[model samples]
Target: MEANKFLDAKGLACPMPIVKTRKAMNDLLSGQILEIHATDKGAKNDLTAWAKSGGHELVKHEEENGILKFWIIKG
Candidate 1:
């Protein structure tokens, strides 16, 4: 997916990915998408839940070569 911002949170753990994702999302306008690349396994669930709770949309996600990629559309 095309995103307005790209956040590389690779090599980070747990809450750090979510923390950075939140901060990056804050910089986006409503409807803009933030693409996040993280290595933390927990980020999959955490980011999905965070986006839902924040009224954002989790457009898509995938894991490749030990990396987790997420696309979140700002609400």
Candidate 2:
């Protein structure tokens, strides 16, 4: 199953994007995928750290057209 979630926090910074993602992920089932779109450069480390601490999985990360994208799976 390729369940996908989208989180758009283009203007938010630091922990905000990751915070919003954590909130959204509370409703997700295990193994569900989340695709986050953020403009903050910190999103890269923030999302990765959160995923590691929370026992989730980070599948991919990239920057395209200035948007920081992340692919994560719920724990």
Candidate 3:
């Protein structure tokens, strides 16, 4: 999936990835995508929940080489 913006949250833990993601998403318009790369294992659940609660769309997600990649569309 393509993204209008990218956030490198690799190596960040806990709330940091979500924190940065929230900030990045703030700059996007509705329907635009934000791609995030994170190494935190908890980010999968964290981001999924956050996106849903925030009314954003969790478009796609996958893992590769211990890295978690998420594609979220702003709602």
Candidate 4:
């Protein structure tokens, strides 16, 4: 899917990916999508829960070559 913004959180650890994703999401209008690329193993779970808790939609996610990609739409 196309995203309004892309965030590279590849080298970031736990809270960092979510932190950056949150900040990036804040800059977008409702229904816009934020695409995040992260290498941290824990980011999948962290982002999934964070998206739900924050009322955003985790529209799509995938793992490729050890990198985790997520597409989230701001609620």
- Show the colliding residue pairs in model 1: none
Question: What lDDT score belongs to each candidate, Candidate 1 first?
Answer: 0.92, 0.87, 0.97, 0.95
Q: After TM-score superposition, what is the CA distance of residue 22 in candidate 3 from its true location, in Å?
A: 0.3
What is the TM-score of each predicted model, taking all chains together?
0.96, 0.91, 0.98, 0.98
The digit string of per-residue lDDT tens for model 3 on 1-75 reads: 878999999999898999999999999999999999999999999999999999999989999999999999999
Q: What ranges in model 2 sit over 4 Å off?
A: 1-3
Tens-digit per-residue lDDT, 1-75, candidate 1: 788999999999877998888899889999999999999898998998999999999999998999999999999
The clash count for each model shown is 0, 0, 0, 0
List model 4 lDDT by residue over 1-33, tens digit each: 999999999999888999899999989999999
lDDT, candidate 3, at 65: 100
Model 1 is weakest, by summed lDDT over 10 consecutive residues, at 13-22
User: How well is each residue in 2-40 modelled by candidate 2, as lDDT tens digits?
Assistant: 447788889997778988999889888998998888999
| Error at 26, model 4, angstroms | 0.8
Best by lDDT: 3
lDDT of 4 at 72: 97
